[model samples]
Target chain A: MNSITTPSYAVHFNQIAYTELNKHLSQSKYSKIFILVDENTHNYCLPTFLAQINEDYDFEIIEIEEGEVNKNIHTCTQVWEVLSELDADRKSAMINLGGGVVTDLGGFVASCFKRGIDFINVPTTLLSMVDASVGGKTGVDLGPLKNQIGVINQPQMVLIVPEFLKTLNERQLQSGFAEMLKHGLIRDAAYWESLKAVLDFENIADFIYTSVTIKNEVVLQDPTEQNLRKILNYGHTLGHAIESYFLESPKHDLLLHGEAISIGMILEGYLSFKLTGLPESELNDIKASFLARYKKTTFTKTDIDTILTLLKFDKKNSHGNVNFVLLKNIGECAIDIKVPEDLLKEAFEFYAE
Target chain B: MNSITTPSYAVHFNQIAYTELNKHLSQSKYSKIFILVDENTHNYCLPTFLAQINEDYDFEIIEIEEGEVNKNIHTCTQVWEVLSELDADRKSAMINLGGGVVTDLGGFVASCFKRGIDFINVPTTLLSMVDASVGGKTGVDLGPLKNQIGVINQPQMVLIVPEFLKTLNERQLQSGFAEMLKHGLIRDAAYWESLKAVLDFENIADFIYTSVTIKNEVVLQDPTEQNLRKILNYGHTLGHAIESYFLESPKHDLLLHGEAISIGMILEGYLSFKLTGLPESELNDIKASFLARYKKTTFTKTDIDTILTLLKFDKKNSHGNVNFVLLKNIGECAIDIKVPEDLLKEAFEFYAE
Candidate 1:
């Protein structure tokens, strides 16, 4: 167990069990309700998933063309016009039954419609249920930038039954699992050690539950991501750069979020070992554990250099310093730690081969 | 005193001295605050106003071309982009010091930028301080339609400093004063009588305070205009139709809000007389009092006919039967009362000569 007790929610993550869903969907008068889904969830996740929902509602499913590239103000305005034509009154609610992009976009639409209405989150992705749902942040990307325009408003509640994870390919599942692992590594060493035995889909449920608990506690401490919440950005600092770098490249689908973060953690662990004098054993253990689980993708010196350049544009660099969250130990984190140019170059070489 | 209680806020008018404004201005943290004015206020009202507000704020004045014709999505967006580039942050507060249109549009634009920021209302026109600011119903009209898209958020607090009425032209002051009289005719008889003596700017400060108090109480009872609040829509049933019709005409300056509503009250009061056998004396008192105070405009048969045609679009007309708020006496109101088409035409002709 970790000694760090920070304020956060006690988020529960499980399969979207039928009996579990039926319990909460009692009908009320609605002007008109809508379910927003993205292309992926529309095909892969929504059909059997909606069958599990208990009651009937006067609602239609609104689907947008898939992918993060479509998450912009134009898409949001289209959704708003549709809702307006549908005669969505104050009594209406939107069920965002997809991943983070769907919920984030849906929540933004609902917040600005006739000056805001209600929305419920049904996060289908592992990254979404544990992280996005617990935070009240909702927004859309501006042009090519990330989350440039948004608002902070909490959902009525988030339904985190995680059975939707079944449809995800192995790569997708592993991508999500990386965030779960980082939660344990940054907050609870015992939980980190406990995870060594079970890192695959077969045991993703219990691990998801524990990871959510750790994240909820972090959020409860600082919901705004002001101070301690920066710790959650540990692997994400570099992980996002790597994800952004690979997203524009020819190697896009070879990895998902968890896969990218797993790589980020490996390189960051190497950085930890080199600069912080983290015990060599712990460093190797973290690397070998992720290597054993996540499928490795090869990147050249140029890819790392491109990623390093992109890191400077990160949204969190408010004061223009590239800050990293480095692990002092398995259960400890120190933020705003900058690494040297040569050290970063050397860490990327650890995976170059 | 009229036997009817003033319904919580029906005390007669009273002035708030310049010292009161100085005291209230000291409480806000703003280093430099601004008073937004239009061509009308700039020419007719600013000299006395600037003299009074001296030393309270490092005030900056901005003027826009006035009139309801200027209220459009383009203006709102322009105002937003300007406010954003001006470096107005969370700490800065805008004092919307104007009539209904300025308060409505200014409050709406300020509410949406940077997601939202704080603002206060110092309503110069009676229509705003009494109804718009008190209920926090801030939004601009979309195109020719009224508040077709908007939000409901409260101002920091509405300062009911009515001395600003002193500079309003006789017609402009009466344009606002008509709504105050409607408040009494619909909700408080004592208030209606109180206005008979104090409708002029000489006694308007006290009356403005009472009008604000009455409106503030009614709004608090039902802030969203969901149920109990709809009672406040007494004269507004046909009033808005007459207002909208006049708005589209080249002769808009010939008809202000009070003139349209005075005509509406007379017409709607005639409907009450028809339905409830409200004494002819009360009906005549309604016509005589509005005529006694207002320079009643002569509406031709075609003008009256067009206004009646437009009444069908009033938001309160749920099934399009033209629901009316009728006065049983000076203070008593009956909601959801429907009037016959022929009777409405007859009421319009009641003052045709």
Candidate 2:
């Protein structure tokens, strides 16, 4: 497949990814190469990743625990100290070879280690490849808050080897599919329609490539998420709050990022219908598409209130207002709209239905 | 005094500093204003800083404990949680009002909080004003390693108020003077000659301004320290190792940053004479000037060996080689020169003299 160009770096796919990666490794005078992986990727993905690197430089694998709970500064500190202990210098390059947690935390680790070092993202999960792969956003969660501490530092390159998706289970694959579904909802209705069909995990390369293209286009226009980029947060406002709530609550089962956001897209879709002139027919389509793939999640009134409280901490919020990107249509979004509290509760009811 | 313009921001001095700052505050629609200080600054500098901000905004003070020992990632985590808990959003602006610890740590905090927010540096200490003010080098140290974790992100502006210098003692003033002397040693003999005279702490504004200009010029030429910027690290290689050694060791009196680097300049001066052809007469001149201001200290063979081990962790090291910036003459220098382990021990002996 063809490589997608971002302002600072490129995303190369499949067989071409290895070529580009090896070329970059051989050309840059990296003192040492440190591959960052989590427990899952270290066992399942590292072997396949190791075979592709043609460089003769010294390679070291730095592994951390998997999951969002482990994605915090404390983990970053451990990785940083490890990098320091192993004598990783500014000239040393890091390859983040796992899901979002590893890539996000590792990118932050490299960016702040000795005031920034070069890193490449070899995203191992479907969710990471589609969403985290493009944007220069690299950060870890702060307590219950997600991506609260990070910088908008770009990587040297991103290698998306779809074959790595073989390591993911059905639920994990569906988690990444949610973002691909979002790309169609926010910017491309036709793409959204195509994504509703039952997807073969073996043939997901094209969909992943297209999803990245949509995200990259939005990110390129507003790299810092100033105005135009707010559209990308269509489902994320409530999605993130829900994600944080599930992540922290001992009583609830942990929701995968995509799973929570899938619920978010439905809730926000209802908000769009009421507030942003999103047609009721389009809202029904969005709701149906997500619910088919994701199991319907019911939030208690108390759970709804707690999740609403978390919205104030959203990064996109400005001047004490929780801003939402509601859709005017399936392929179009209205940025920075505030919905009333009662309406937010109503949207939760719509999702519960 | 005229405002000095950096590529991205300006260094406004004295009355103009307040005017520029107030103007920035009034003009930008920051959601809230956060002033970060240490315990010392919160008590000593905050009231003075608060009186100067003529804008009406909801102000929040986030104070950390004072000292170089507290400049670490753990401290940063605490500050990050505080910002989050306080509802510091992307639109919120932070004013770092204190010495290098506050400015460096606060800048890192602001830079990473919600993927960076606008921050201004109000450096209080002489060392911070001369060294940390203009470089955009913001970070916290990692376990015994000085500035091992940081990013080269500039603040919105730097407000250099000479009046704040009155808060420092003689040792602190001498500590800042070391960097000013370094400016002259690496780039300007004329400036070096001018700085050799006994300076009045009360009348050091012009000297501070010139020092910033000298440092800014080097940074602008090579912002990322790719080549020409390496010249700025002339005394820092050995200086940082010495600083880290003194910082971590309980047996030694805590050496101020400038105090340790001043010793570094003298030690590197000897190495320069041996390896880089720094004239013996000039080397003696460098030695006499620093010795008159700083107390001479003796290091045992074992202490020297421990410091040598710390050199491997210096940010400037690349490809397992410890690089030093050595002076070829009073105003000229060589960069990336490797000193033999034996020569390093000899330089410590030279300092002992």
Q: Number of the top candidate by TM-score?
A: 2
Give me the candidate number with maximum lDDT.
2
Individual DockQ of the candidates? 0.13, 0.91
Give the lDDT of residue B37 in candidate 1: 69
- The residue-by-residue lDDT of candidate 1 on B266-353, one tens digit each, is 8888888888666789889989999988766777778888887666645455423567777777777777777878888888778664
Error of 1 at B44 (Å): 8.2
Over the stretch A1-353, how does candidate 2's per-residue lDDT look in tens digits? 89999988999998999999888888898999999998899999999988987866689999999999999999999999899999998899999999999999999999999999999999999999998898888899999999999998999999999999999999999998888888999999888888888467889888888899999999989887778888888789999999999999999999999999999999999999999999999989888888888998878888998998998888888787988999999899898898889999999888887
* lDDT of candidates 1 onward, in order: 0.69, 0.91
Question: Over 4 Å off in model 2, which ranges?
Answer: none
Candidate 1 chain A lowest-lDDT run of ten: A1-10
Return the lDDT, model 1, position A301: 72
Residue-level lDDT tens digits of model 1 in A1-353:
22112233223335433443455456444456688998888897778767766667777788987667777766876786676555565567788888778988888777756556778778888778766766677876644334544566667667766678876777667667778789877889998888777746865766776786788778778876667888888777677778777767775563566777888888888787776666778888888899888877777778778888766655555334577788888888877788887887787777654
Candidate 1 regions exceeding 4 Å error are A1-27, A38-46, A49-57, A60-77, A140-151, A166-203, A211-353, B1-115, B140-145, B160-171, B197-199, B224-226, B235-329, B333-353
**iRMS per model in Å:** 5.5, 0.6
